[model samples]
Target chain A: MIKLEIKLMKNILGANDEIAALNRKLFAERGVVVMNLMGSPGSGKTTLLEKTLVRLVDKIKIAVIEGDLFTAKDAERIERAGVEVIQINTAGGCHLDAAMIQKACTSLDLNAIDLLIVENVGNLVCPAEFDIGENFKAVVLSITEGDDKPLKYPLIFKESEVTLLNKIDLLPFTNFDLRSAREDLITLHPTIKIFETSCTGGTGLEDWCTWLLQKVAR
Target chain B: MHEATLAENILNIALEAAKQNQAAKIFKIGLTLGEMAGVEVEALTLSFDVLKKNTPADGAELAIKRVPISAVCNKCGKIFQLESYNFFCPACDGILILQSGRELLVDFVDCE
Candidate 1:
């Protein structure tokens, strides 16, 4: 057998990207806006979703696709908020891929939904790399995670269009430098919209919901 | 992080390429990974080794070239290598837009 080199410059993430594009097309065709909510574990993504749904459900139709490593706990919480939700258990997978999101999208009624929030598996690194065909990628970083996180996980900060500085109510108890975090995040992504949020204290839910409403309206 | 999944995709792509070339065995696979690709080289290599077994692309060596992270200044448009992981322009102090840091691809395959 003769050794031969076949030049094939194919992207490794092509399959996932293709599927994500399909999802994006589907959402656009149905006049639905999708946001891929990403963050580290315990970044208060679920709580924020619950609070956002509570504020905006009466205004527009919203649904959720909850992603977790195991258990349907988050889906249950979203269900309690009176929103149609589907849980995707990756078992031990680090992040949710476009194929998984596409499968989850099947369970939802696309025509009835104005907005679809895909709560990605709570991971900072891997989740940032995969696009789930959402209109925007929003990341939540708690004050407790420290200000250096934007530098440590540049991809998440850079990829996201919005940053929810969650757990702001606990700012006084922790050494998290809110200013430095904001500066670093802005440096990484100059156009990124930021919000200081406290789910427990209900600090910035109103503004955040208002922003979401605007996106759905657009 | 998702290097294992990436390894699988690489293997499958290599297998397909080998078949297209009408080669019975894959010898080496050329992969290009960026610094900001969020993939560990060691982990991806290990995963590829484990998955290549019992496949048409068995015992294939992955020749991976890691591309360094770089960005272009949004204001001045000066491109520079991001050695310190800082996303700011040194010349104009402008916000640097990422140029080519986040890429993972199968460049080519050598087969027989």
Candidate 2:
């Protein structure tokens, strides 16, 4: 004898989204602007973040929640920049979901914090699928990466509110086709803002900073 | 790499449901995997096989339903499934933003 149950097949994402919504409400009430920074492992996410922290340390209180496979080095770098930082080692996990973020938030002082930057584990695929209760998703695509990245991984490009084309200083050296990259991304996401910057050279960084400040104001 | 974790989640959900319904054995479990879920079905199946050995769901059959890639046209506000990698709307050359292809769900269970 066997019984068949016809469940509605609710979205498995429901759990993660519910936690994300809660985090959003908490952020709104506390006037905190949370940014979900996503990119590949070597896309210069931490380097760009370090630059941002250097510029905004005097104006606004910032905190960082670093997600990694197995290291506290990034958290240490952020801590040395004179701000509160928490490191989440996913162990073998590919992405950081809202529940993990909620646990990390318990250690930070949300009252005094104006911005909370959650650096997701460096992976384009899984991170984009998980909602970590962020106001917006910011992606970093270094020029060193292939120009076909946007076409290969369309989800990250489509889901991102802002895309940072990092490592512009190396553009001259690499055979990266900028025109095709922009065209491919525009085909997927027309409204997404694209920024060209190099954390190493400090080129085209003001735009990213301005964008960050604007989001914090809202 | 994350197959072990995903398998654990699946087993947890199945066991909880089985306990609620007083099921002596689980017959089958249904899963919906989206196109862009970033999870490998083969790896998941392999993980389930190894992890379910001697467990409550030891003999349970796993059935997978794949979700197709879909997008919504920004200009026309129309949703359609993509048969290929092209992201442009066929009716119009408007950019199509992704609306699906990232689902991961455990839809139903068979118990006795």
Candidate 3:
């Protein structure tokens, strides 16, 4: 028996990254801005999408792709808000990969849409690992989830280009520290855009929508 | 939780490589996992062991090399190892930019 040694240096995520690049090119050619919205299970992502769509649908055409573990509950909610929505059930998977998004895009009219918002699976750890061919990644971290979350799950915050500090209306009731969270997040990503939002009162929705519109225009 | 997917990818890549090299059997697979790659070693190993059966890489040993997270200070230019996710520079209080962590790669394959 002869011992054979093979030397190969390869990236494990090379396939996923390749598909993501293709998706990026397609989105660019279609002139549609895509955003990957991620957060915890109860991070108010659905509510945030509702608020955003209600505000921006009249200004620009928008569509959505909703990802979940089992059901179309979130997609149903987005549909009620008045827009074209596609649902992807991961069937017990933890995250949405680039290939999934590429397949889902086939059913939609990319020419008619100005923006495409993909609501990733509700996972702080796993979702951060996969790139779903988004122009930008935004993470929603509600105030009630504890301020230590930024330091604990640094990858999600670090990977995101924007952060929605949601549930600001409940800040008075919770012990969440706004200062430390900001500091930690800034330390991790110095140029990250931060927005404080409250879907219930529509407190910071205008600023968030405005920022998103600006990104789309550029 | 996604380690299963990663393990499957690893095995698929190794098998493809072994077949390309005209090898009959795979004896070992080597991996390089970094501190900030967000992969759990034990779970990855378990998934690889389970998925690698009934193939050329059956009973293959997973040799993983763990790498520590390190960064270079922008202001002071001192390289330092980071732990517990604190990225503040110890020398000049400047934010330390990442230098070496966040790697997830298949290094090599051993077969005959």
Best by TM-score: 1
Mark the regions of model 2 whose C-alpha exceeds 4 Å error after superposition: A6-8, B84-88, B93-99
Best by lDDT: 3
Question: What are the per-model DockQ values?
Answer: 0.76, 0.51, 0.70
Total clashing pairs in model 1: 0
- iRMSD for every model: 1.4, 2.6, 1.5
List the RMSD of every prediction in angstroms: 1.4, 2.1, 1.7
Better of 1 and 2 by TM-score: 1
C-alpha TM-scores of all predictions? 0.96, 0.92, 0.95
lDDT of 1 by residue, B33-102 (tens): 9988888889999999999999878878999998998888888989999886677788986888888978
| A103 Cα displacement, candidate 3 (Å) | 0.4
Chain A TM-score of model 3 comes to 0.98
Show model 3 residue runs off by greater than 4 Å: B73-79, B87-95
Tens digit of lDDT per residue, candidate 2, span A1-218? 56757463755566678999999999888889999999999999999999999999998899999999898999998898998999999987888989999999988889999999999999987788778888899999999998999988887887899999999999889999999988888766777899999997898888889889988886
Docking class of 3: medium
Candidate 2 chain B weakest lDDT stretch, 10 residues: B1-10
What CAPRI grade goes to candidate 1?
A: medium
Which of the CAPRI classes, incorrect, acceptable, medium or high, describes model 2?
medium
